[model samples]
Target: MKIDTVKGGAYALTCTEACTVQAIRADAAFITILEADTAGQYSFVAPGEAVEVSDENAMVTQVLKPAALGVTGRSGIQSGGDVVLRNLMAEAAAFSGIVNANGGIHVPLAAGAETDTASVNRAYAMGMAQLVLMHQTRTYWLTSSCTATNGVTINHAAPGCYCEVLLGANGGTSLTLPTTGTVSGGDYSKILGYSIPFRHNGGAAGTWIKVSMLIGAGGEWTESLDAGMDGYRFRPVSGSAPSIARLVEVTLYYHEGYKSRVRELIGVGKPPGYVVRTTESSLNYDSNTNPCSAAYRLVITQSEISYTSELGAVVWLVMGGASGDTVVKLADIRGWDTYHTSVSPTLYLDVQAGEYGGRVHLESPTILNGIGNNTYVRYGLEPYQRSWITAEAEVPYKEPEQPSAS
Candidate 1:
């Protein structure tokens, strides 16, 4: 049978007796097949798609009688198939399919605000099922750039299950997930490996980082950095501050019955034909300014680079001064909001006639520095740009089965 459906509509099919469904097909996407009742009832979301259901064996029965005698054949036997036996087999198959599709379990939401001690209805993960639960407990909607830490706790975590945390920040600041637990009564040592670090790369609001941790049967945790936007490297933490991850969204996946290895949760790669161009401009400095007293300022001329967004970039600095007078230190490369005392150059370009040029890599851009004497400085930069990976949660629909009479 074929059914025409409209967008955002729910459809259901019911049968008095058990029947075998050969196949189900849809023309459009977002089609979710759900079992609404255990008594031969099924439902699905069409999402404005055309759906077709084919049932070759549809509970048909035909009886054969003796020619001479008026004795009827066996009560449950039929020409097409054994009526009672076929019904039982078909129903069993349908139930199996439902259980597999719904991840072998259903968890109802619990009371109380979501926090480190939040709990949900208990359920088992049987067969080769993968149950995923998503929650957003600590989230910050910032009007300005600031550093903050956030975390969530998952109680009664199933063995072999894992959790993923999506973190995002603004204002070219750092967002870190520490190895030590920051949440009260929370033990991060259960998670294996060191801390996870994520640099926003000084981009706009949407850039995010993904951190994944697998829970062992003994409650030991194995951690991995799934993916990050471009310009942000994923590596072990080296004495960084506690997690400044401004926004936190956690997803828990139960892989108790899963036999195979867990795959990477997120995909990260750049598009084709992507390139970075170098932007060069001359620095302006006042000669009357005391070299020992005041610092010389350098501003990026690129219109695409904004102070409010996209802060970090790669810069090439070249300065000309007397033998003893040369550029000595970099004060603040991250604009006026944050300051860095002295930073070493990533790569040295040239050093001649009291002239020095080097590649200065900064986490935040719009360079400001202090020079030794009256000098000329020229700068170049490869603006910050990156490809983002967006993480999404997919949950199956399930309805509680009604209790049968005693």
Candidate 2:
């Protein structure tokens, strides 16, 4: 029987019927027959009784638990330009398709620039259950007719390092420089700057290396490297005009890592049909704010269910994305707020994402329909963008009845 019995303590129960008193929570305590049944009380026993309190209330059975999955080899894949990633698993498997994925991605590819800022290039989520981690970007200032040589002191005086200057030259042009260098007290000598493994101090500071490369008459050079003393700057080798193909821009993407064979998440790879995430428009809803109707919406909406331990309402935004695609897509979801949000007595947040978009779901709590919010949430609508975000709680998650024999 269920009673507030502790390890070494006992309570009085004036039984009306004969029965065995068993600890409903076996792990909690043990019940042994205490006193003699003198005045019409037939002494009872622990677990089962001589003086009955219940007919069939006690049992001795073993319980088995699900196997534990190891969290080893679970790391994220860094992606962007020429870098596509496998699903980067977030905070464990909430269910099938949704994970608490968080990380950054670099889009090395640059978006085409428009002289008219009004014509902002439009971008879309990978679509479907595929999640959009983040959209990142940066502008560029193109230059021409610059000159630089080797042994240039960039960010430091002696031991500090310089930012990597990735260079791309137009035409049959090439750069000859040290592949590696070690700085001693602010100096590394110089060598024929074109060869790899050239030593510093020999390839050191103040030791000018000849700026040489195969350059066509109209060829130019571009680099992320800054200029320093001597010929350490990057420019035309000699007798070459800056080509039209100079430095323009770059972007990167970061993402989470996943093992397809292990965690069979249907939401990671292919488009899982329509998903309903968040809307870009700001609106006050009496019931629910439907997604706004427009073209190039770039986003779609659909639904499914998942789980969460968190009760109440939570706003899910695309924190960032990880992929090797060149173009970066940004999602602005913070322009949202909540009011009069209600939740289950006990619950967890579940997330569902698919082709339609992504949504915030609850982990099947009780009183399911009560898993909704009356507060209005919205975003600043732009000329060339659309959005989707989902609520993270669903209710009426009733515990299944114990199996019964027919």
Candidate 3:
């Protein structure tokens, strides 16, 4: 007898007739008929008796992470006349051709002003411009001023005492006088007055120090100095140069060496469904009605398949992305919204899907006592699958006696 089997866990069998020549030719066909001691069933196994199942699906194997490259150094060279240092910083950040990729950078500068208000206002304006720039290019800059070099001394009972002034960096042309009475080495003293930059107290105690309107002029701007009482030698790093250099530093920071894929997918074929993890909130809207925007974000995570020995190929699939907007980013987003209304009044980006990885567009209106009232909406993505099956069971099987008891 011979049998054949197919690939699908099934087989075929064949048997020859008892009177066939092949049967007669068998070597010693049971030499003589032997009676069986017991009767037994003889069965033939068929290939169809067994079944096998296999699965073949695609999955992510590895992910190439993103990288970031930050600006290392920047400086504003040279100087211009009558310009606001703070404004220069803002302008530099705005005009710098640095790619930010939704990331931001900060630049520092020197502070100059006579009154606290002047300094504070300058800082505020610079900060505001940075914010605006972030909306457009997503970078920022900050300015810092040098600390006071010397303290002022007031002759305890005298109405006014001649104070020694030092020269600091674009000819800090003018300086203020101390409001507090001085006799000390480490106490804080306020710089008063305007129009004349002065170096509180520095240089050799008894050294001859005199101020003149001109480099060596002996008239008009002439003033004599007593010993520098700040316990430090005060002398211009150079003869007499102004320190008011109106310059703003510029820099940029952004992620690099990282690649991304965006894809817009639609349900297709028998059961079409797609999943997406957004990088950020897509919700945006008019600001007049509701001042606040929604606070959720989406980011995508991916894995790339690299094992080629058995599988032979690798593909990356986005598993998930960050969700929930951080409070800090949310505040910035709110400020951006306010800026839009005050300046342009139009919300910029809309929800859209990518093509390479995953994309989805969704709407979430602000809920207001079932009335829905917020200006912008934010949302997170949830994964979904199509072509899935679900099953349910009927009531449990029971004996008739159980029914009678019931």
Best by TM-score: 1
- Residue 157's lDDT in candidate 1: 23
User: What alpha-carbon RMSD in Å does predicted model 2 have with respect to the real structure?
Assistant: 30.3
The clash count for each model shown is 1, 94, 48
What does candidate 1's lDDT look like per residue over 231-276, in tens digits?
A: 2122113332212111111111112210101111111123211111
- lDDT: worst 10-residue window of model 1: 345-354
Best of the two (1, 3) by TM-score: 1
Model 3: weakest 10-residue lDDT segment is: 331-340
Candidate 3 lDDT by residue in tens digits, 305-348? 11111211111111211422122111000001111111101011
| Model 1: lDDT to the true structure | 0.22
lDDT of 2 at 201: 12
* Candidate with more favorable, higher lDDT: 1 or 2: 1
**lDDT, each prediction:** 0.22, 0.21, 0.19
